[model samples]
Target: MVLNERYNYKLSYSTRNSLIMIDTILKNAGKLLVRLSAGAMMLTHGIPKISRLFGEGPVRFHDPFGLGPEISLALAIIAEVICTALIMVGFKTRLATIPLILTMLTAAFYAHADDPFGTKEKPLLFIVVFIAIAIMGPGKYSVDGLKKKKRSLF
Candidate 1:
């Protein structure tokens, strides 16, 4: 009977440990998935703006903040491309999300304000995702996580 109880305790302990591992995996995987998808989608918009910035003659674009067309375009590109790349790699994710969140806000409110809901819907969704990422943080599968682990060991 003692042997049976010992085995049962070991089994329960191992099960509990496994469940914790699974939970960690789920959280990390969820972060990675969202980060990658959001970054890639934003890039679709960003890359074109990049080309337009460099390849065009006169910088023709909207100036939502009254920052002038070229300045606004530069800001958009920075947020969409540089920041998104940082978020995807899980490097300084919360900081990276700041620019992205700002960009989405500008798009949804100032730029698309005069347009229909269809125009505003996309940026609004992006804003929500970016906000979530900012709050939850990059999980154990990220560069930030690796840095944290290294720090803990030291």
Candidate 2:
């Protein structure tokens, strides 16, 4: 009877460990999915802006904050393209999301302030995902997770 009890206990312990491992894998997978999808979608927006900014013509972009059209477009590119790539790679992910969140906020509030919900919905969704990523982090499958050599910013 004692031997049987010991075997049962071991089985239970092993099962518990397996469950914990599965949970961890799921969480990391979720993080990676969010990072990749969001980065890719935002890049679509940023990439087109590049041609507008660098093309041989006068830069004509929305100057929502009075920062001038050139500066505004530049900032958007930095956030949507540069920062987004960082987020996708899971490098300094939390820091990267900051610029993205700011950009989305500006888009939803300043640029589309008077627009209908259909127009504003996209930025709002991006804001929620970026906020969640900033809070939850890049997870164990990322560059940030692989590098434990030093203290990270996030």
Candidate 3:
């Protein structure tokens, strides 16, 4: 009977340890994914804009809704490029998502409005993912983590 009790305790301890390890791994993975997705998204769009800014490519402005192509493009560059870097680094993630969310919404509503919903899948997906990131935050590993640590120290 005593041997059975010891075995049960050992099993419980092992199970607890495994669960803790799994949780830590998952949390870290979530952080990495969030950073990469947000970062890559920014990189994909920003690089082209940066190229245009440097006069490597023609700056194409499609202001069908009359929002002004130049203004829209400028805002896109700020949100997609600047905010994306902030999000990737996990610095002020919540704040970063605000602009990102607005940019996605503008793209979906103004730019891709004429496109069929199915055809506008890319912007739609970006909107959804941006919203998700806004809500979930930058996860465990980030500048936010450092800020949190600093806060705890004080």
Candidate 4:
């Protein structure tokens, strides 16, 4: 009976080698999804605002928090453009999420505070995604992952 159990264990171990391949595929897919979502969201919102800043549309902004329109626009551009690019490229993904999360929080607090929960749902969703990315990392396909590997070789 013991010999039979040992043989079965060996068989299972050999078959389990495929698990690594599955894990690799899943990790890559997840990385792609995260990059696309975060990157696209940032670009869609940031590009227009940036264009407005530089273009002839309107440089003036209405600050919801009563600080100043210029201040608000500057902060929004930084979080949307700089952080989004970093996140998309998987460079310092975890750290990049800090600004993204804060940006979403500010949007929710200042812009969506008086709105209904339905109106605030988008920012809330972004907050959750940013938090999840911060915790889970950018996965194996990211620059951060590559850096870790290179560092470990020493």
Q: Score every model by TM-score.
A: 0.90, 0.88, 0.78, 0.82
lDDT of 3 by residue, 3-121 (tens): 26646533466677887899987987787696787579667977687656557456676664566766667777888899889988888988988888787777778777888888667
Per-model lDDT? 0.91, 0.92, 0.77, 0.80
Best by TM-score: 1
The sequence of per-residue lDDT tens digits that candidate 4 reaches over residues 1-154 is: 1226647534355456677688887987797698768679767887788866677755687586676876788778888889888888889998998988888887877777899989888888889888888888888777888898899999
Ranking by TM-score: 1, 2, 4, 3
Q: Which residue pairs clash within candidate 4?
A: none
Q: How many clashing pairs does model 2 include?
A: 0
Candidate 4 off by > 4 Å: 1-11, 56-58, 62-67
Q: Which pairs of residues collide in candidate 1?
A: none
Q: What is every candidate's alpha-carbon RMSD to the true fold?
A: 4.5, 5.0, 4.5, 3.9
Error of 3 at 45 (Å): 1.4
- C-alpha displacement of 134 in model 4, angstroms? 0.2
Evaluate model 2: give its TM-score: 0.88
- Stretches off by above 4 angstroms in model 1 are 1-11
